[model samples]
Target chain A: MCAKDETSRPKMAKPGRSFTTLLFFVCCLLCLLLTRGQKDERMSICHLSSCGSPLADDGKVYGMCQGRHGLQVWGRCCVNVTENTHNFTVGLDLSGCNIHDEFFQESPLLTLTHLQALVLDNNPITVLSSEAVAGLTELNYISVPTHSNCSCPGGEEAWNHLIRSVNTTLCLKQTSTCTRYNEACPASSSHCVEDGPGLFLCLCKEGYHGYKCLRQGTFPMSAFLAGLGSSTVILAAVLWVLLRRHVKTA
Target chain B: MASISQMWRQLKSKYSIYHVFVFLLTFFSYAFFHATRKTFSNIKTTISSEWTPQFCNATEPCLRPEKIWMARHLFDSSSDAEPFLGWLDSTFLISYAVGLYISGVLGDRFDMRKVLSLGMCLSAIVVFVFGCLTEWIHLYSQPVYVILFVLNGLLQSTGWPCVVAIMGNWFGKSTRGLVLGAWSACASVGNIIGALLVSQVLDYGYEYAFLVTSAVLFAGGIINFFALVPSPKEVGLPEPEDGDDDDDDSEPSGEEDENGVTPRTPLVQTDTDPPVTFTQTRPQAISFFQAVLLPGVIPYSLSYACLKLVNYSFFFWLPFYLHSQYGWKETVADEISIYYDVGGIIGGMIGGYLSDRMKKRAPTVVTMLLLALPSLWGYSASPNNKTINAVLMAVAGFFIGGPANLISSAISADLGRQDLIKGNSEALSTVTGIVDGTGSVGASVGQIVVPLLHKQLHLDWHWVFYFFILMTLLTAVCILPLLVREVRSMKCFLNYQLRRQAAALVQDTHRPHSLNS
Candidate 1:
């Protein structure tokens, strides 16, 4: 009976210590989850109202923008009216704006990723290239000035239909740029995706990343996290024991 | 079982457990205070980039996909963002300076352990909410950020006074210099820890840096609440004698010898007295006005103000200067700048030891401050070689940081326990608060003035170094009166010692002659 009592006491003490350690880890995990679960509430829109000039309240641009469900006319740009939701520019009209070719060289319009229909009918832009309109992935319809030699954003082959009117040229039926650029990517380990109207980016497939996507396997994040957590706990325990011994001795 | 119990008893008798515990507890508590404070400086660049509008240009034609927040639109241009960031720093420092006076009084009146731990916990929450939760929730209001920082500043002010007063309560004058000197490194250590943690998790996002630091601070606060014993009296141990009673007797006479030197006879007589019992009743807390009037308080505080201005200017601008002047990467500049803090740690320990050995604080401080001028000038003149820059920077740090640490910690402790206060331990916190509070005000002014000198005045970086040299000279000048007194006292002390030795030798010869007769 005496031998059994001594053996059972050691077994009981082992679980008690482990239980507290487990509890500490559980609390840390809960804190991390709580902080991570918060909803992102940032307004996504153009920073300034005047991309150039404010649109008249009763003008054609305002009418066209107001007809959309969540769109509003801010200067020359059509952006989301709602401040809370995550949204971006969907329409822009720069007709008769007198903007030059240098404007497209480092265009702010590239940030309007959700832009669908763009009107550039009366501008003096002469050097618009596929590179200038890059990152405008959702653009489907675009009207260019008649005298300018600017092609459709991704070139003539990218659009399914093109109409040359008396005053402007309209391009429609935008096709995916990835289909044409897929061959540019590494064959086995990577895939190509359209980043913008004329830009295609090659992304490494699962478990591959490096100069040529030759490297394999992702970072062992779980192992690293586990190691970090356990080490912190161990260090804390050691410090506690050391300090406690000093207290006990005195 | 009997042998084990006997061993435990032997170990208990050998160590002063409460002393070690108090030191570790206060050291880490103040360290956590500084760690939370340092998180903002480390993440400033990242915050600026995130706040300013990004444009896709000819060289870089890709939109940042993860930039899906209003904070990106907070400023239309980088120029607008820079001034606002500067304002945040000014607000924190100004509020911190104001709060120090209040915290000092509060620390004396209330239980220090509660004040310290609670302040830590609240400050941690403020930082976590402002830097982390705001990022998570994408809250970009400027006023909210300012308000949170103000509250954080006030909470942080509780840290320094409480920790210093607690150290004063535990340790006596004999070991205060060395102990507090080493303890003072907690700030530099905290800054290094904060920088390392920020750099480690900063690649993930700036918010992660805030999360890690605040979490560490909160954990430290919880430990402090459980473990800390604010004074030796609480644990039934006799409080260490402050050594002020000996000075108390000499100060009243105000007598000088014929050569116009204060006699050191009384100071020598009390050196061999038995340890006094802890029988004096606790004194009431001193008012701010009274604390300011204490001997050595004004000189030290004024000197500290000038010294802190120079020190804080280097702290705030070093990385920016290194990056801009040398064209180094921001991270590389930041990593290199830590050499300054490492030098500070070593300088503080050496200065403390030297002052303790010499039994004079003001002379040691004045010497270091005087030396800092040359070091500062050398750092400015050196070529842009990384090794040379780092070495000169460390040398400047050693001279400047040494005196700053000595004044704020050991000197503050000395003044708080001076004989004029009649050994009132309650006044330590208030005295510490006054000196450091004044220093913070100087630091806040430096933060604003340094930028104005560079940007508005167009003095350039080299010219600004000249301004720092001027400030170092002014710091030495402020303490010149105290230095003179300490030197005079030292001369008298040496004279007294020589005369005593001669008298003892004569008595020995006479005793042998009398015995022969």
Candidate 2:
């Protein structure tokens, strides 16, 4: 019912407690004050390294590190991400491009019509938080391929569970051939037909139709018709604008 | 559910008395340790004032190749030292590595209070030992520092694990990493404190700088040992507050059940793995040596090595790089170092805070690391004007320090969420040694690598910056997969640990009947 110290050593203050104890007490007070003052002066410190002051560039400002390094601008951060779309894919390869992290949540990645596939493969993209995944809906594919080289062989499965729990089809894997949660084989895997998680492959045997080559890429023309319908809105806007200008001129 | 007043009372009962005393003792000892250790760099002006005449005999305008050699006083730079700084890092790294595993294993094997106290005692003794920095008397300071650092690395490692073990027993896992990491942000606190002390006495005395630091370390060690309780079980308290009915606690509990047992109530380590328990399970328990090396040491080593490259470079050369490149005075360099430290503070706290809040450690780490990569790449691409550069440096510092602080501080403790080391006193120390010693080696390589890269290319200092960029980028790549594995494994590990604890609890209930009958 009770947990107690195992050792039963007699409690006697160190032999010179009276004399040194006073000195130590004062010293402790002094350090606490000194350290406090030090803390106040340097209270801005945080986890990642950052520049101390802002570097003014004509009208553009950048963060300047004490070590003479230059930080990127927010606008530049956007540019950097956009310009290196391929790099984001590499970020995928590196597992350093989690779209669900704050970068996507806080930044204008949502408004950036330029971003295509949002890859979060191998990165800790397990967050199903609403904000973290909000901007990610803009992308065509949201992949967070789980690492196969894990202590648990079911990383993909867990990842699928996380994605599924959110009720979003943001793929957390590159191929639908996740060896977890569902029954689908990867397009890349040698096994043309195998059951897997979040993975689907159609291994068309000589005359098959869908998955397992049975359905092929043939959707009833209605899916393509739906895709065309979305584009018509844009064309309608352009035509409306052009007609308004013509009427005003006439 | 516990009320806020109940929590306040708990804090009062726990830390109000003895812990306060422990805090004060630690605070002072740490001051002396830092004050004395860094004092040498400041008094460069005074020492050179004394020795300048001998070197520049009446004519040649003191051609020492170093900018401020003869006219320099204490804490000033010396042409003589430029070459030595590189190898000095090596000395520290090699010695630190030599005892890396031992420090962790031994700290665990023995009473950590004793081990930590001794580490502090030696840091103070050796710091003062190096106080008389004459050519001959201080020759061994580097290697002695290595030994000191290794032990310190080991000792400081003791800090988190002990705190974790206690906190693990006292608090829930929900806020443990956050609190520990917030506590871990003390590293930045230590650095800033070291810098401040340097600023105060840079003109006064250099040796006292280190000696004071040693004293502070001694004090902190004493406080830690005296105040640190092994676990809540040891202190006779129930597991964390507000546990009665919280929705957050439900998922973890369920997660634990599916895999067999409920994942340990997020953070708090239940009263199970005492020395007696460990001994009782001797035949059945996983071997300490095997567990130490397999997943524990291996991951720690790899991550440590990768991070070391970045850590060592930033810590040792950041100030110098600022001063030399920006034409900053000593005061300015010291002041500016705060930016990096400040970012680290935020990173440390946020990294842990967010992880615990979300109940996911690996996700936090991976997210931060991944986010940091672009920042690192951006920071590295250019080093144009000073103001802009400074701003980016702060941002870079945030990305680099935040997640790093999270892992090194709180996540490391969480990683050892296993049976043998669950809330054990030595868990943090082992992780620290594994992470920090490897970081030391990275520092050593940066010491040599950056300088050599600059030497060969005759390019701008950006070359050195380039080296860090590649290192950070590479670190992100290598760790990405590993962390994914960790996250997946952790899910199961949590299940397994909970099952083991729950099973043990059940067995303990059955034992009374069997024993009495």
> DockQ winner among the candidates?
1
How do the residues B284-350 of candidate 2 rate in per-residue lDDT, one tens digit apiece? 2223455456344455456556666776567667777777777778677766666776776677678
Estimated TM-score for each candidate: 0.68, 0.51
**Every candidate's lDDT:** 0.72, 0.46
lDDT per residue for candidate 1 within A1-250, as digits (tens), equals 3223322322233335887556544543554455342111111122232234544465444666879776765446676645443445667677766768876665556666777777776678775677666777778778887765676766677787888888888878677767865565556767776766566666666766443343455434466557655654665566554343222111
Query: How large is the C-alpha RMSD of every model relative to the true structure?
Result: 18.7, 39.6
iRMS per model in Å: 10.9, 39.7
In model 1, the Cα lDDT at residue B134 comes to: 90
Residue by residue across B1-517, what tens digits does model 1's lDDT show? 9989865644343225566777888888888788877889877767776666544345443332323212267776657778888899889988998898899888888878889989998998999999889977878779999999899999999999999988888776656778888888889878878878877776556777887888778777767766676765553345555643323223211321211221112123232432233233456888888888988888888888888999988888998999999998987898889888878777888988888767787788888888898999999987988999999999998999888888888888788877677446478888999999999999998998898899899887888888898888988998999899888887777677667667878988898999999
Superposed by TM-score, candidate 1 places the C-alpha of residue A160 at a distance from the truth, in angstroms, of: 8.3
Task: For candidate 1, list the clashing residue pairs, or say none.
Answer: A135-A196, A249-B12
DockQ of model 1 vs. true complex: 0.03
lDDT of 2 at B423: 33
